[model samples]
Target chain A: MSYELYYWTGIQGRGEFVRLALEDARAAYTDVAREEGDDVMSAWLDGEHEGALPFAPPFLKSGRLVIAQVANILHYLGPRHGQVPDSEAKRIYAHQLQLTITDLVVEAHDVHHPVGAGAYYEDQKTEARRRAKEFRESRIPKFLQYFEKALERGGGRHALREFSYVDLSLFQVMSGLDYAFPKAMSRHDVPLLRALAKRVAERPNVAGYLASDRRLPHSENGIFRHYPELDA
Target chain B: MSYELYYWTGIQGRGEFVRLALEDARAAYTDVAREEGDDVMSAWLDGEHEGALPFAPPFLKSGRLVIAQVANILHYLGPRHGQVPDSEAKRIYAHQLQLTITDLVVEAHDVHHPVGAGAYYEDQKTEARRRAKEFRESRIPKFLQYFEKALERGGGRHALREFSYVDLSLFQVMSGLDYAFPKAMSRHDVPLLRALAKRVAERPNVAGYLASDRRLPHSENGIFRHYPELDA
Candidate 1:
């Protein structure tokens, strides 16, 4: 069956997390938002489908199904796409890891949009600086430590070994941090993270996707941005 | 199999979302943190099991399985426990709604903590005014609108015909907003949400839980605080 993914057209945003798992699993799916003049994302949220509807995008459609939330979408597709463990317990564990990655993603977004989403990043620069410092100094390390321990247990450096969905997302996390806070991340004791990123990059499917046209470049438009002041 | 729940003692926090679902389903589980003493939250985060480990609390342990992330845990248990949809599509939609509720929870916490988690609400009161105003003005209506539409789609009143996991979370969100911004929620167009809270409260299990000692009350020590200054 052809799976349809609904998300914004241009930026990777949260959709990239879902994309990584699908690409890594070699799942056959169409990126619906990028399709020509479809307006499918809005349609999906506008209640075109039956059963339960998603509150927002990065949702998936498999036949008659419409699934949403980045982690939830991945959780729904984990076993089917060959990206996670089969048992009920391991499945929940994989989703738990993805949700934590999602939390970090929100923190990353708030580094730029601290005061409010309606207010421009420039308008909230002061708050962003304060939030960014806290993010860089405290949260990043705390979250990374957890990921490191997760990696340590899952088989070290590879983060859930065999390169799961969370690993790909973590790779993006390091990539975004490096782009947004080059100085701080460069100074961080992230040898394990760096190694894992390198491994994720070397994965044939991901390497191909990164080199291909489908992969979007890091931009000021997305959650992670290159703001020199926010960086340490 | 026995389900073991790991969350902080004293306050419900994010764990209460899962706790409500578990209780409503009458699922048997141990509140690990309360059992081992409140400070045991840290050790629980440290992974007190073999195989898979949780990065933080508000996790669930079923048999040898350890799961983290409140939304993920609830999504994992909701169906089997009869608190959620049975289909994959419906399941993901329920999860998406729950994740959005989790977002609101984080946002509500940040209403008091826009500065940083490392800083106290007292230290960040000034910044919180700016954040809380935005939350009340923009975020509340925006999220409440989404819930309103979901209710409309589900045939009005309840957000999914029968109560789902997100409906339980919706009750908590309503409860939280009421505590955080009494005047704002009181004046807002959150009729569906307010109604959902009443419905969830009247649920035999939920009402019983809320009345029982098992339910934690809202206080200044938790996410939704009745800071008179913070309120409208």
Candidate 2:
């Protein structure tokens, strides 16, 4: 049985979070658009006959059943992939953490595109400057505190601390944050969270993928981009 | 056999989502804050608690384990309580829908808060106006299209064609939107979605919940507020 992932091929974007989970698990799958091209992604979503997948990017097709949402995809891949725990409770807990990470990801995306995703960041620069400041100030602490507590509550060691799917996502998010707000993150002094990112970076498969060509470097095109003005 | 639901007592807020599901199942549960008071909600989260129940309110406590997140709480309650299906694939699909609902909830919240939840909506009114327009226009259609397709894809007249946990969420979201933006909703004729909302509203358990004092009425304090200005 083959697995196919449909997403915007180039930018790490939302799909990267799913990719990290699969890459870390060494799961067999195809990044459909990355290889086949956008016509495929477009056709895959808006083809004739009106039969399209649910939502957009980061959908996983396992046989006939197609699943969307980044957290949902990871939740599906986690158990089948051996990346998440075997226990039902543990799995659900990991999913909760992943969902929280999704919250953080949306916040990051908004820092740049506070007006509208369809509109250019330049078009929304005035509003974005306002939104980004608040994001760096208020949201980071509120969301991160919730997560730091989740790590603490979920047994704070790693983001998952027990080799769960959420940890991989936490790593990806932290990486994105680092790319986007290096100064802010450095000043924040979240030592444990930094350590957690370092630990996930050291994972054998993840580390291998990071070093290999398959992994894309964080860039301005992605959700988390380094804009010095926004960071401050 | 006792269920304890933990959430901030005062604001019906996100906790209400969980309340709707439990009430629909007609399950026996205690709103912990309602019984235990505000201090208990704070104390439950305080302390160097690792693997603590959940990151925030709207958590469910069954004996020793504390389940958190509205979606996660519902996921835990769905199968055992019969709000969702028993099959693993169906369960995942149920979760996919809930996660999408969660995203929608975030979007709704962002409309008022825009950049910061800690700040007042009036403070962000300028930004809110811009965000609200996008929410009413773009986000509504995007989410509606996906859910409408999911209902269609479920291969029956009903969504998931059966009463799943997501069906209630879809119904609730539609209710929230209608209340929040009656003018906008009235202008746009989303017949498929409107039909789904009606079906969910007429469900035996849900109908009972809406009639009972147990279900909180839609208000300005919650995610979907009926602000006339934002409606247009």
Interface RMSD of each: 1.5, 2.3
Stretches of candidate 1 exceeding 4 Å from the true structure: A37-40, A48-51
* Docking class for candidate 1: medium
Residue B141 lDDT in candidate 2:
77
In angstroms, give how far residue A70 of model 2 lies from its true place.
1.3
* Residue-by-residue lDDT tens digits, candidate 2, A4-63: 888886788998888888888787889888888866766556523232245567788888
Clashing pairs in model 2, backbone N/Cα/C closer than 3 A: A153-B51, B158-B161
State the weakest 10-residue window (summed lDDT) of model 2 chain B. B47-56
- DockQ for each numbered candidate: 0.72, 0.54
RMSD of 1: 2.1
CA error at residue A83 for candidate 1, angstroms: 1.1
Estimate, for each residue in B180-213, the C-alpha lDDT of model 1 and write its tens digit: 7888888777677777789889989888999999
Candidate 1, residue B200: how far the Cα is off, in Å: 1.7
Worst 10 residues of 2 chain A by lDDT: A44-53
**Best of the candidates, DockQ:** 1
lDDT of 2 at A26: 83
